[model samples]
Target: MKTSAADTPPRKRVIVLIAAGLSVLLLAGIGVYGLIQGPRTGPPPDNSEADGPAATAAPEDGTQTPGRIVPVERSSDPETFARNVATAVFAWDTGAGFMPLDYTAVVMEVADPTGTEQAGLANDLAAYLPVREAWVDLRQYATTQHLEITDAFVPEAWATAQAQAQPGQITEGTTAITIEGVRYRAGVWNEKPVASEHEVAFTVFVICEPAYDTCHLLRLSELDNPLR
Candidate 1:
């Protein structure tokens, strides 16, 4: 994808609830991630289960390149990483020769690293691969995309998992865990419609190795409401 920066159009904006399709990103093993009204604070529950492994302040790769079409650097800060990821999820460039693999590669870069802990990145990738292929096949070209972080809050499930996780161990296998409250828009070029616009509310689920210290994207899902 070698789209010219000048050819990029101003993002067209609209507002609506996220579609059900994105919610299906989760695998059968884990149910859809959801959010509660307000933040919760308390001691770890007796039966609380955690996801993957505990968070670690691992050194981030200091790689940078000009003219890079996609972002692949894993960040030390999960919130910062999430906001950047929200943009990537919504935006694409057909002029730049963007492909589905390019999009998913960036996604994997921000996903929890797979190793001894079994963060389930493989499962998330498996679930998203088909959707990515379908998206590239359907939306042949996209002119512009945009994302806004209207608000952000820890989902109740993730919060609980964090509380329950041991100092060096992150809870794994829970169906809940995500950062909710995002708005997105994109301008797509398709043969049938020729051109189209999409706007929706969505969330990004992530795994934090040590509670909130370090995290990575797990999956993206649509939300009925902004959940602000």
Candidate 2:
């Protein structure tokens, strides 16, 4: 039977509390991604000719060009599933006629089946994706972003957290995978193509196997902060 948050066991509650605290820290501006919050006044005025033609406008039908970002095929393999979730979390286009919530929905589609973690997972995504205001600001530059994963592993901290859990406190197949990657962003600035890249790391908590035939996302670590 599904249990309410108030009915969650003590150890499980501790884990959730820890994740919540991290979310608070992220919102407080600690380690916030600068690209999203940086100068929003649009590209500089002087580089018009050097930058190339202005980016093509979004389709009038309100559809993404190239293609919409979507998650990889579902997998029973924990590592594969974690990578899929990581990709879905980081891939987005501000000019794609989709809001941050649209991208958030992609990940939430595979969230905890019991619904226990969906709310927390939504909070987790908020830390990774720009808010609606920031999204609009980025759209002006026609910005799009994706991640190139460099490494993924079960971090030692996850093992430690597991060790502290009381029997049955954590779901049967739950695990945490830390993903390290380079975030790449591209857009038109002054009518010219411009791009930037930054290294990022985060932990994805998931459950797979006996818990379900395919893995499901549970929560995310603070951006640039991964279990190690």
Best by lDDT: 2
lDDT of 1 by residue, 96-185 (tens): 455545765666665544331223443433332324433443333333344555655555534443453334233332123234433322
User: Over the stretch 1-228, how does candidate 2's per-residue lDDT look in tens digits?
Assistant: 233455433224324534544454344433322212322234222223223333222334555554565765578888899998888888987776788888888888888767776776777787777766656767777777889999999987666655655566566678888899998777877657877777888878887765666777877776766667
Candidate 2 deviant stretches above 4 angstroms: 1-69
Q: For every model shown, what is its TM-score relative to the native structure?
A: 0.46, 0.73
lDDT of 1 at 56: 15
Task: Tell me, by TM-score, which candidate is best.
Answer: 2
How much lDDT does each candidate structure score? 0.39, 0.67
Q: How many clashes in candidate 2?
A: 1
Alpha-carbon deviation at 79 in model 2, angstroms: 0.9
